[model samples]
Structures are given as structure tokens and as C-alpha cells.
Target: MSRNTTTHDEFSDRTILVTGSSRGIGAATAKELAERGGDVVVNYRTSEDRAEAVVDSITDAGGEAIAVQADVRDPDAVDELVATAESAFGTIDVLVNNANISFSRTPFLEHPWDEFRDKLVGEIRAAYNCTQAVTPGMLEHEYGRIVYVSSEATRTVRPGFSSHVVAKSALNGLARSVATELASEGVVANVISPGPVRTEASADVLEQFEDQLIAETPMGDLAEPRDVARTVALFASDDASFVTGTRTPVNGGLLVE
Candidate 1:
């Protein structure tokens, strides 16, 4: 594990794939998992440099990781991603769906039909393809953990984010269905719905909504990416053995549900 491992080999001997891990929350999750003793595949569609940087950081800290480029929305690419990860680390035991979150800020009425459809389709398609590609291997091994990085926007309404919310909402259903159907197969699925997270690229967003979110949240600050990453690690850990088909909020107690 990396230097951050807290005396727990929580993910030892496990192989985890974190999609869109080149930056932000995804990168944090990849590093966190590696620190917890997982051999991680940092998957990215582009930003090879950033992806490599993530891998380098993990390895430099004595953790196992590799960077692989694959568009999770494409089934063929997802299949290849699974194969490559399995080739490197033997098999993937955990899958983190953190990509396909291109947010469009057009107002509901102004949103074009094609744009709306693409947003929803792209989001779900990526989940569908990755789930299909990884589950067979997971089932064959009789062990699997799938974590979807959803958004707090699904429940907390936000202007100009209708399509984004709708797409994220679909993941709730997907997580439920997958968890119910696969739990008996020794596989589990769940979600980590985060509120506005503070990341390197979120300055403009924070400038706009930080005060409002902080004022409403009991925790009084936006969650850092590591906070969400730690939750993802928890879901992927053996500690979450009895947890499945559930949505855990990492939103600083803003939406109490």
C-alpha cells in the first residue's frame, strides 16, 4: 500500500479499476485505493499525461498502479480495459464508475432534444458497458464490488443542470438493480453521492455556490475530493460486506436523507 495506509490491508491482493482517474475525485479515489493495498488501474479516455502522473505518484509511494486509456462509453474499449487490467494484476475485484459526467448547463426549456438525449445516453451507456465487461470476471471469481460516483444534484435541484441530474438519477436505479441481482452471486453495488466537492478545477463553481452550500451544510465546508475517495474505499472494502444497493451521501450533511 501507499504511505497513507492506516495499518489496514483493506484491499490487499485486490485489483481495482477507477475510471476517469486522471484528475479530481477519480484521481483521489485511485490513490486512496492504492494506499489501501489495491493494485489499481487508473483508466482515462484522454489526458495521458495526467493519468501517468497519477500512476507515477502511486508507484513512487510504493503502491501498485498503471494508467490505461479507454472510453468507458464504448463496450469494445471497456472490454479491452478489463482484459488489460486483468492481464496486469490477474483480475479486477472492484470497479469504480466515475466517468461520463460531462455536465451541460443549458436551462431545461432551452436544452435541445439531441443534447438531452446524448447526456442521458452517454452516462448510462458507459455504466452499462463497464458493468457488462467486468461482471463476468467478477462472477467467475465469486467476488466483486462496484461503486458508482453519483451526484447530490439528483435530489437537490439545481438550475441549468436538468440533464445532469436526470442522468445521475438513472445511476440510482442501476445500482439498485445490479446490487439486487448480483448480491447472491457474491457481487455488490452501491453509490457515493457527493455534494459540491472542492477540487483544483472547481474555483469558478466554488465562487458561485460555496457560500450557499456551506451555509446549508452542517459540516460548514465543501467536501474535498479525498473525503469522497475515502467513502469509495469504504464501499470497496471488506468493511462494507453487508452494504449493498444503498446510496451513501458525502455531502457534509446538507441533504439529511
Candidate 2:
């Protein structure tokens, strides 16, 4: 790494895993962590090509990274994914719970039963799986940071976003509970709720809601994936060791008004 690059020994010996990191917020957060000197494990459920691409980008930029595949909804797969990261980098230091699948917005009355199962099971189950998998490693070392990528929809309460909002809210609750349980063990957990990030995933859902979102947001601008990624990095960094058990909203100052 060059002098211009920061390979902070702060995390040089650590492995940071970001789930669903093939693209979007997960990809951005993986890159950010890698750039800061942590060995990165990029976990993807299906996007092998994109995951490898992210790995290559990190390696090219003088950082170490490897792509792991797992359906986070499956507990066994998540355990394997964590084992792969441990085998690659020795110890897991930071785990970003970013593996989320978006379901179409539909009124609760019109929402299909399958969508509920898919959205709820996918989001909440994955969080539980990944956290459980990496937690032992954190406890062994007596140091860890867990960052959960959540949504502002929990606060926004968008009409058609019932499932996602509910799932994210549950995720935040989980983080809070874990923070209290794990703080005594030197582990800190926090949730980042980003509003209207302009990622490919968000593009599909934002078109219909951008106007309403922007009008409601105090900053009057859409957030970029990088914006949310930065906050994830912050929460995972030593700077936030004292911060935990709370919801941090990065919605361009939205939800305040």
C-alpha cells in the first residue's frame, strides 16, 4: 500500500465480513472496510460474478479480499460463510449484516402470503444466522463490532412497504437486544437506517416514492450507497466503540421533521 492509501494497523490483523456484498450497499461497505486495511470477506447469495469483481477491485487497490457464497436465509449456509472467512483471514472483527432482498411494495391487504414469508424470513433470519455465526469469534477475541444495515422505512412507515419496514424494525430491535447482551463481552452492535439510497436495488423502488421521500426529507436530496457505507464504516470503526444499542438514521437528515 502507498502512503496515500491508509492501511491502518488498526484493522490490519482483522477480518471484516459484509453479507450481500456483491453490489449496492453491501459492496460499497466491503470496499470501504478493505480500503481501511481490514481483510474483507464479501459474501453473496447468488451474484458470483459481481462478488468476484468486488474482490478483484479490493485486491487491485492494495487490499486483501475474498468472495464467499451463502444464502443468508439458511443458518447452515451462514455458518459456512463465517467459517470460510475465518479460514481465509484467521479472525472475524467486524460483521456487516447487509444481505437483504427487496420485495415489491404492495398493500398489506393485497400482499401475498409468499412475499411475507420471503421478506420476513430472508431479512430477520439472515441477521440472526450471520450474527450467531460470527459472535463466537468476537467473544473469543473480546472485541467486535456488528453493524446492521437497516432502513428508514421503519420510521417512514410507507404504506406499501409494510413487510420491509416491519422486518427492518425487527432487525433494529434485535440489534438493541444484542447490544445489551454483548456489551459486557466487548462487542458493540448498532443499526444504520438509510433512506432512499440511489442504488440499483433502490432504483426499482425509489421511482414511485422519490417525490414523497424528498418532500419529507429535511435535506431534500437522495442518499447514495456510499453515504450509507460511510456510516457503516464509522459504526464498525473504533471511533464508535462507545456507541451501541441505538438506531442511527442516515437519511439525509430526514425523519426529523
Q: Which structure among the candidates has the greatest lDDT?
A: 1
Error of 1 at 112 (Å): 0.6
Q: Which stretches of candidate 2 lie over 4 Å from their true place?
A: 1-9
In TM-score terms, candidate 1 sits at: 0.96
**All-Cα superposition RMSD per candidate:** 2.6, 3.4
lDDT of 1 by residue, 59-164 (tens): 9999999999999988999989999999999878999999965756899999998999988999999988998888998999899999999999899887998998
lDDT of 2 by residue, 66-181 (tens): 99999998898887888888898987999999989778789999999899778987898999988998899899999999999998888778688899988888899999999999
TM-score of every model versus the real structure: 0.96, 0.93
Q: Positional deviation of 150 in candidate 2, in angstroms?
A: 0.6
Estimate candidate 1's alpha-carbon lDDT, on a 0 to 1 scale: 0.91
